[model samples]
Target: MAAAQDPSLFLGFDFSTQQLKVVAMDESLSVVHQSNVHFDSDLPEFRTRGGVHVHADRLTVTSPVLMWVKALDMLLDKMKEAGFDFSRVKALSGSGQQHGSVFWTRGASETLKNLQPDQSLETLLQDSFSVPASPVWMDSSSRKQCDALQEAAGGALRLAHITGSTAYERFTGNQIAKVRATRPEEFQKTERISLVSSFAASLFLGGYAAIDYSDGSGMNLLDIRSRSWSQICLEAVSPQLDLLLGDPKPSSSILGPVSSYFVQRYGFSESCRVVAFTGDNPASLAGMRLQQGDIAVSSYCLPPNSREVKAVESDTVFLWIADPRPALQGHVFCNPVSEQAFMALLCFKNGSLTRERVRDQCAGASWEPFSAALRDTPLGNGGNIGFYFDSQEITPPAVGVHLFDPQDVQVCSFSPQVEVRSLVEGQFLSRRLHAERLGYSIIPGTRVLATGGASSNNEILQVLSDVFNAPVFTLDVSNSACLGSAYRALHGLSAESGASFFDVVKNAPEPQLVAAPHPEAKEVYDQMLQRYARLEERVLQKSRP
Candidate 1:
C-alpha cells in the first residue's frame, strides 16, 4: 500500500447479476486491489443457476435479495481476511444491474440504520424485505403492465418523451405495477422500494438511499426532463408511489458516511463517505469516459429552461437533448456525472455471448482461429449479410439468426469465415445505424472508444474502426462499472464542495489508440449499409415476436 501520508484510496462495488465485486483505486486512478464473491458456487444454498431464477414461462426472471446481502457479507470478510486496509478508503460508491429492485418491508429503514456489528447483514436483514425475489432486467413478462402504462401516458411517444423510454417489459415501473397487481397484501407490507443500485447503496449507508437520476431513468416512472418522479406516470402505477420511491438525487450524491457496522466490524473509517449508486450501464458509461458533442452540446452551461433535448429521426425516434438529429433504438439515460448531459445505450440480444457462440461453432472454440477467420474474410464478405439475434434484439426488436445471400435472398448459412464476418459486420452496422438515428454521427476525426470482451481483439477493433469509419481506442479497464463507481466516490467526496466528475477523474488512465479506419472503408461499406438496412427490415418481419 502507500506510505502513511498517502492513504487516499477510494472503493467501488459492482452488484452485478452473478457476482459481488469490489475494486479499490488509489488517488492516482490505478486499481490497487480487487476481490469478488460469485453467488452460484459460494452460495449454493440459494439454488440460483446463474444468480437468478428463470421462471417456468422462460421470460420472467428474479433474484433473491438475501443472496446479494450474503454475497456482500462474504465479500467483505474475504477482503478483511486478505488484510485489506479499509481505513485508508476515503469514499465508496456502487452500481448494480439496471431495472432490478428490492422491496423493503415497513420499518426496515430503522433495522437498516441500527444494523448490529455483532450480527451478519444477511441475518439482521433477513426479515427486512416484503418481497424476497426482486424482478431483474432479464424479465420480460410484464406485457400487461407495460400495455397499461403506455395507454395511461397518452401514447408510447408521449411516455418516451417523459421518461426517456416507452413501455419496456423489464423496466422497474412495470415490475412494480406487476407486484402491486398480483400481490396486494405484500404491496401493503412494503414500506419502500429501492432499485438494485440504491439498495446496494443503502446497505453501505445504513439507511435508505435515494435512487440516482441516471438509474431512475430506466424505471419509466421518472420525468427525464425534470429529473424527478412523474405524477402522471405514478398515478398510472399505484398509490403512494412517491413515498415508495424516494425522490431521486444526482448520481454523484454523497448520502452519508459508512455505517457503524462496517466501521466496527470491518475496521472501516467512520469518515468513509457513501456515494449514491446507479445502474450498471450508467456506471459503465462513466467508466468508459465516453465523450459527447461533435455535432451536439455546444456548451456545458445551458440557460435555465433552455431546451436540452433534441429529437433524432432514425428507424425509431427517441428524445435526446442535442442539436444533431440521428436515428436510433435503445435507451437514453441521464449521464451519471452531468445532469445536463445524456448517454445513449444500444443493446443486442446477440452481444458477446452470441459472438462467443459463433466462435464455438465456426472457429474451433478459440479466439485465435476466430481472428484468423475474421482476417481471412473479405471486407464486405462478397456482399453477403447476416442478422444474428439468438435472443430478442432491443434495437431492431428481432430474434433468431437470419442470413442473406449476396442477392439478398434467404439462406441457411455460409462458410465459417463468411459466418464470422457476417456476425461482426452486422453487429457494428447495427450500432452505427441506430446511433445515427440517436442524433450522433461518426464525425470527422471521431475516435470510437472500444471496451468489453470483444475490444481486446485487434481484429475486432480493426473491424470496429472500419465499420464506424473512425479510429478505435481501447481503455485498459477490467470492469468499467466498478472503476467508474470508484471514480464517482472520489467525486462524491467533493460534490457538496463543488467538485465536478471530470475534475475528480481527470488524471485517470488514457484510452490507447488501437485501430484506424481503412482508406477504402467508406467505399467498402456504404453500399453494404443500404443492403443491410433493407435486409434488416426483411429480417424484422421474421424475427418479431
Candidate 2:
C-alpha cells in the first residue's frame, strides 16, 4: 500500500463492551463525523452466566473475533446509510478493551472460513467444554492461574519486572493457563493467542496476527523493556501457552490492507490501511491528551484502579495509577500496586451507573440536590451506610472477593435527592485515602482532571472536589479512550513534531467546568475517611482466611 498524502481522512473505531463508536477525522485530527451503534441487550445468549446465577447489571464478555466482524459490518452499513463513501476512507484502526484473549487454530483454513461467515461466526465462538468463549478483561476466574504463574515465574516482583504487571487473572497469560488447566482438550487445539485489539486487526487484515506494545503491555506476558513475549515468564506457565503467543508490533505499523474477502463482503476499499491496535485504557489516556502531571481517571463502574486493588489483594478500593515516567526511565518499583510520583489514581468499582440509578430512582433530583444531602449527612453516612461498589472485578487480580454484605453494609436514611451525593462523596474519600496511602502527596490543593461517564455530572464533580479538597476539572470528551487512541495514532504519524504528550493535551479542547473544593467540607470528609477505613477492615475480616 502506498502512503497517503498529508491531511488524509482516517477512520477510527472504538470497540467497547456495550457499543461500537466510529469517528471520522482529517489528518489534522479534527473530528468530522461520529456515530455510535449500541448492541441489543435482548439477545438471550449474550446474558452473562456462571452456573445458575446470571448478572444483569454488568457488561457480558463476548468473543472479540466475532464482535470485530459484527462491529465493522455495522459501521460500514451505518456509513453507507449516512452516504459516506468507503473509498474515501484512508486509514482504519481501533482501540479495544485490553487484556482479553483470542485464539485461532494454526493452519485451520476450515475454521477460519467458518469464523468469517456471519451465521457460522457466533456458533463457532460460543463457549463449550473444549472451545471456551473469549475471557474478557472483566472476567476474574483466574486467581489460581495467577498464583500458579507467579510462583512458576519465581515471584510477583520478578513477574512485574518482566511483564510491567504482576500476574493478573484477566490478563492473557493467566487466562491461557486457566484454559490449559481446566480444559485441556481446548488448550491442546489452540494456536495463535492474541489480544482482542490485535485479534480484531488480524481478522480485518486477513490472518496476520501482530499486537501493538500498548495492548501487549496489558497482557502480563510481555517484557515492558524489550516489548516482546517474556520467555522466562512463558516457561513458568505451560509451554503450550507459548504456542498461542505471537510477537509484539509497534502501535503504528501498517499490518496489511483490507483482505479481498473483507473488501468484497463489506464494500470496503482495498487501499484502506489497517494499523496495529492498542488497549482501551492507554488509548483513552492518549484520547484525553494526558501529559506528565495530568492524570486521566475512568469513572465508570470499574474505576481505573480495579486492576491495582485486585493485584494487591487489598480489602479497600484502590485506583490503577500509571506513572508512564517510571517506565520511560527504566526504573521498576518493587510493589506493582504502589503509585509512582507525578501520578496517583483511585478506582471505585461502583461508579457512574450507581449514581445514575440513585439519581433516577429519586425522580427529578439533580446531582446537586443529591450531593447536598450527602454533605449534610455525617461522615460514612453517620456510620449507617457502607457502600461497597464492586460490580465487576478488575484484572490482573482475581475477583469475587467479598466486597460487601448488604446487612453489614448499612446506609443512613437520606433524602432521595441527596443519595447520589452521598455515594459520590463516599467514592471520593475512598479514592483520596487510597492515593495518600500509596505515597501520593495528596495535598489539599492538588488539581485532578476527571474523565469518563461520571465526569459529566456537576454534582459528582463538586462532591469529589470537596472530598479531595482540590480543584476537580471535568473533561469534555465522554469517550476519552477513543480520543486517546486517535492521539496515539497521530503521534505515531508525526514523530518529529517535537511536541510532548502534554503539549498535545494543551492543544485539545478545554473542560466545561472546574469545581473548587469547599474548605469546611474537607474536615467532614477527613473524619469520614477514618470511619471508612474501619468499615473496610470489618468487611474484609469476613473474607480473611
Candidate 3:
C-alpha cells in the first residue's frame, strides 16, 4: 500500500563497523538514491606514561568517528555529482555500529560554529582531534574496568540485572571507566560522551547531545527498564554525570535541524530533519520487519559469555533478572541472546577475509573458483580438514584469542586447504551448539537468517546450511544496517499517527530471497560437529594463560 500522501525523501547514513553507506529513499521505501564510501581512523590510546617508570608498551585502539565524517563528505560529493537535488530531501537519520562512543568537548561548539559550508575535510581533520576519536565498540582493553564495575555492583548478575547486558569489554561504560582510570587528565577534559549514532546525528544537526535507547542498551549504563540512566549504575561508576554522558532519548525523537553551514556546504536541503540514531543490529532487525516471532540473525562472530551455566536439577531458578519491562510492550521472553524467537546467529569475525587470504596464497584462486571448489568438497569437508573461524564465540568452549597451533605458536600449517576448511567448519559447529544450548532444537527443519559480509558468499552460506542442518535465508540488501535504518525512519513517520511497530513493518518491503538447506549433507555435519567440540576443548586447555 502507498502512503496516505507522497512521502518525503529521506537520506540515511549508516556509520558501520567497516564503512559508511548513504541511501535516499522515498515514502515507498524505494531506493531512489544511494552511495557508499570506505574509510578508517586511528584507535584510542590505552595508557600514557611520562615518568622514568613508564611502560613502553601501550595499547592503542582506533575509533570510527573520523572515518564516518570523511565518508559522509565523500557521499555528499557523490550525491551532488549524480545531480540529485538537495532541496527534495526532507529527513535525515542514521544507523551506526552499536556501543562505540564519541567524546565531544565543550570546545567542539566553537569549531562547529566556525565550520564554513565549503570547508574542506583537510581543515576539519587538522582540528578533528579537538574531540578524542570515538571509542569503537570492538575494543576489548576495558576488561579491568569491567571487573571493577562488577565488583562495585556486587556481582556480574547484579550488574546485568541493572543494565540489560553483563559487563563486556566493548560496552561504553567500561570504556569510559578505562579512560577515567588510565588517563584522568583526559577524562577531566572530556565534556560529554555520545554514542557514534548520536554523535553523527549531532554533527548534521549542528551540535547536540542525546542518545537513543537501542544504542543506549549497548552502553551498560542505561537502565533498560526505566529507559534512562540508572542511578545505581552511575553511583557505582562514580562518573561526573554532566561531562561523561548525555541525556537519553527515544529512537524516533527529532534532535534538531541540519546546520545551515552543512546545508550550504553539502548542498542539502534546509528542510532536512535530523532524527535520533540507533545501533546497526537493532536497525537491521527493524529493517527486516521482524515481528513478534520473527528471528533476526547475524553471521558476525560474538564473544562467548563466560557466565552462562548449564541447566541444573532445579527446573525454575528464581534469579532477580533485569526487568526488561520498560522496553517490552507486550509479554515476551527476553534473554541474553536476541529477543526474537529462534534467533540462530552464527558469526565468524575472521571468516570472509581469512578465507580470501587463504585462497589467494595457497590455491592462487579467485572467490568464485574457491567457492566452486568448496561445493565439490564433501560434507564435514570430507573429514580432511577442520577450519576454525575466530570471529566471536558466545557459548560453551569459548575461545577469544586466536589459536592456530596445537604445539608451537610459530609452527606453520602443512596443508593450507585443510586449514581453511577447519576455520569454516569450526564456526559452523560453534553456532549449531550455541543455538542448541539456548533451548533451540538443531534439526533439518530449522530456518536461519544469514547476514553480514560473509552472508553474501554462497559457499559460506551453503557450508553453514550443511553444517547446521538448517535452511539459511539471505537478505537482498547488501547493507542490512542501512536498510534497517530506513525501516526505523519509516516507523518514526508512521508512529506520528500512533501506529503499532509491527503494523509499520508488515507494510514494509519484503526480503529478496530465501535459501534452503541441502538434505544430503545433514548427517555428515552432525558427526563432524561432535569432533569439532572435542578439538575445541583440547585447544582451549592448551591456549589458556
Leading candidate by lDDT: 1
Question: For residues 436-509, could you state the per-residue lDDT of candidate 2 as single tens digits?
Answer: 55444444235667766656666566677777666777667666656665555445444334544444345567
Query: Best TM-score goes to which candidate?
Result: 1
* lDDT tens digits, residue span 391-493, model 1: 6666888888899999888899899999999998998888777766656656555667765566678998788788878787776656878999999999888
How many backbone clashes does every candidate have? 12, 15, 19
Query: Relative to the true structure, how large is the alpha-carbon lDDT of every model?
Result: 0.82, 0.57, 0.59
Q: Model 1, residue 245: displacement in angstroms? A: 0.5
User: How do all models score by TM-score?
Assistant: 0.86, 0.70, 0.68
Candidate 3 lDDT, 212-233, residue by residue in tens: 7767777768766566787766
Q: List residue ranges in candidate 3 displaced over 4 A.
A: 1-7, 17-19, 40-58, 64-74, 107-130, 240-244, 256-271, 288-347, 350-426, 436-446, 452-470, 500-502, 505-509, 512-514, 517-545
Error of 2 at 285 (Å): 2.1
Native-to-model Cα distance after best TM-score fit, residue 319 in candidate 3, in Å: 24
Measure candidate 1: CA RMSD. Answer: 7.8
Please estimate how well model 2 matches the true structure, expressed as its whole-model Cα lDDT.
Answer: 0.57
Q: RMSD in angstroms, all models?
A: 7.8, 8.0, 9.5
User: Candidate 1 local accuracy as lDDT?
Assistant: 0.82
Worst 10 residues of 3 by lDDT: 311-320
